[model samples]
Target: MTKNFNDLVADLSEIEGGYAGHVPPEWLQGRTAYGGLSAGLALAAAQKAMPDLPPLRSAQVAFVGPIAGDIRIAVDPIRRGRTASFIGSDISFEKDGEWPMGLRTTFVCMGERESSIDHVSHDYPDVPPPDIGKATSRGQALSFLQHFEFADIKGNPNQGPADYLRWIRVAERDGLDPMVELMLIGDALPPAAMKLVEGFGPISSITWIANVLTTTPETDDGWWLLRSRSDYARHGASSQVMSVWNTRGEQVLTGMQGVALFL
Candidate 1:
């Protein structure tokens, strides 16, 4: 069954002092929920816990273990200030008669305020339109990929430059919240390291951090730009920088990820 993007967000349940949710296999990346889905759900839980906080400023998450089955998300308010707040969230699950932390995240939220400094260090990349690029099928085998479409602006993933740019968005959840959609689209690109390897094996994102620069609402167009570049790859790990741009050429999010490679 095809699951709506908003439906996944709705699955999260508010509980005493925390949140709870179940991840069906349709959203599974391997034996666990997709990395982005897990992070998004955790963020949703954080939002429920701290409703008055401003837009998301930044989120740092460590994928400590696999997230599977019924999971409990616990959120703690680290500190609350006038313009900003720091919140901590964790995903816990029971397996083999023991419960363990599968993921840990710290989210920073900042409210609107007057600021004298306003500038952007970088501009959106110039790339061909999605129609001119090839649609990526490498991700087709993954169940979660069904929720969205990916078009690679660069050539073949294995033969292209170390950099990649793509146009991606949810196929059905057109009205989805921008921040929630960013979580799903942030990791849409295949690891840039895959271009350096001979063939596909396996790569797992160990840690991910996303910084939100703007909180504009989603537009009717629904497409978001995803650009990723590898910084370095060695010792069975790869690090990369990522950014998400809206159709209006606004840089909505910037992120960094560290991935474990088994290729």
Candidate 2:
């Protein structure tokens, strides 16, 4: 039987080693793999290599090629230290009996470091909750959004813009692993939000980076705020910056993405 969207996402949570591989079904797109799936799998592989370290605080990934067909990924440990650990992994798709499509990622774990100075300089827009009433799932009918609820704060479905605010919370049980939750949320913001902005035309992200500021978000059962904006777009490319906040309003993650927008 085919795996449902939630089932696939749940399976991603448990992927380790090369076992994270998936067979593309007829309904799924064959030209390019979803960035979220690749990112989640890479993060999972990284976490497996550094099981003893603190939960994943952040990850950055670069998509070098299209992962359309069958592929394999190998994870390599770059650095393992007392205070932090770094891991690297790559995905390659099979092409002409050889693997192609390259994707690289770095995972970092921040150990117990305390700082008395607490200062934050970012501010979120005071937008009302996105009309949960108008959220739509795009790309390969079985999108990750089907597993959760999404609300759009800006950009109408009819018109395209570059900025968007979304409220997301898993409908499943509370207390999910921090790294897994981060992987899920981190991958959700990039593509669709970038498409909404007009200047960034038909661009695709070549790389994505996310940094986590708090570790407790995994155990909290609350809404997370994803405020995303495109700062600039030029030469058929653009960059987006996003801030993630827990329901209590504490910033948890910050991310930026560079996209290849086609006009």
Candidate 3:
């Protein structure tokens, strides 16, 4: 049976186990699964296999191959411990006499482990939200953003180079597990933003890694502020640091992404 975009998104957000897949629309311009879709599916599979664990605090996914249409995903439970569980999965497209594109992900569950903290120091950007009139649909901004909602804070639109504040969160999915929601939100920041800072140029990420801070938000309702900045670009490589916070003014998670420039 064919499924609508909403239904597929709903399935991805759910807590149930088993394969979760989506057929990208022609408009997406990809014959295979979107990168974010694969990442979210891998996260969901990991979550479903370890439902008793705490919320997923971190996930590092490597896009080893391209996922064609009609993808099939399988989950493997690595370890389930008292305070945390480790899980991983592979997403492959089904085809006759062909290899499928795949991705592998590891999820870490948060627990009550104690730790010592050092001094805290990080400056938050001060910028007003983009006028609602200028707000654009995710489809208007980027093909993948179509599945998400974004509110630009810095209102910087120069394609040459820029950095802006924004609020991002996914539309609700029925039976959506909070962990899946968090993972989707965690993966939404685009690498294109880094290009803005490094001057216009073609860039591709060979691998993306996100480390979830221990103090991530506990709820999904609030608008999380994402402060993204480009720190370095050289030798056909670039990197960006992203800091996420809940609407209540609390630090959630900080992410760093490394990019490989094609040009």
Worst 10 residues of 2 by lDDT: 136-145
2 or 3, greater by lDDT: 2
Report RMSD (Å) for each prediction in the order shown.
3.0, 4.6, 4.5
Error of model 2, residue 217, in angstroms:
1.6
lDDT of 1 by residue, 102-192 (tens): 9999988885677899888766775544652345332454477877767666544433356777788777765555677777778777788
TM-score of each candidate structure, all chains considered together: 0.89, 0.77, 0.76
- For residue 248, what is the lDDT in candidate 2? 57
The window of 10 residues in a row where model 3 has the poorest summed lDDT is 25-34
Give lDDT tens digits, candidate 3, residues 1-263: 43433466445533234475655553132343555566667776665555666766777777766675566567777788887777777776666866365777776776656669665555555444334446633544335556666786544453225354677765444455555655556656556455355455455544556656653455445356676566776787777776776665556677676667666
Model 1 TM-score relative to the real fold: 0.89
lDDT of each: 0.78, 0.63, 0.59
Better of 1 and 2 by lDDT: 1
Q: Which stretches of candidate 2 lie over 4 Å from their true place?
A: 1-20, 23-30, 126-140, 154-161, 170-176, 190-201, 218-222
lDDT of 2 by residue, 1-263 (tens): 54433454345333345434553552232356666667766665655555666767778889788775466667777788887778877777777888775678888877647889878865655444444446532333354444455665554443236566677765542544566666666656555445555544344668888888876663244357776677777777778886777655667888888877666
Q: Pick the candidate with the highest TM-score.
A: 1
The model with the greater lDDT, 1 or 3, is 1
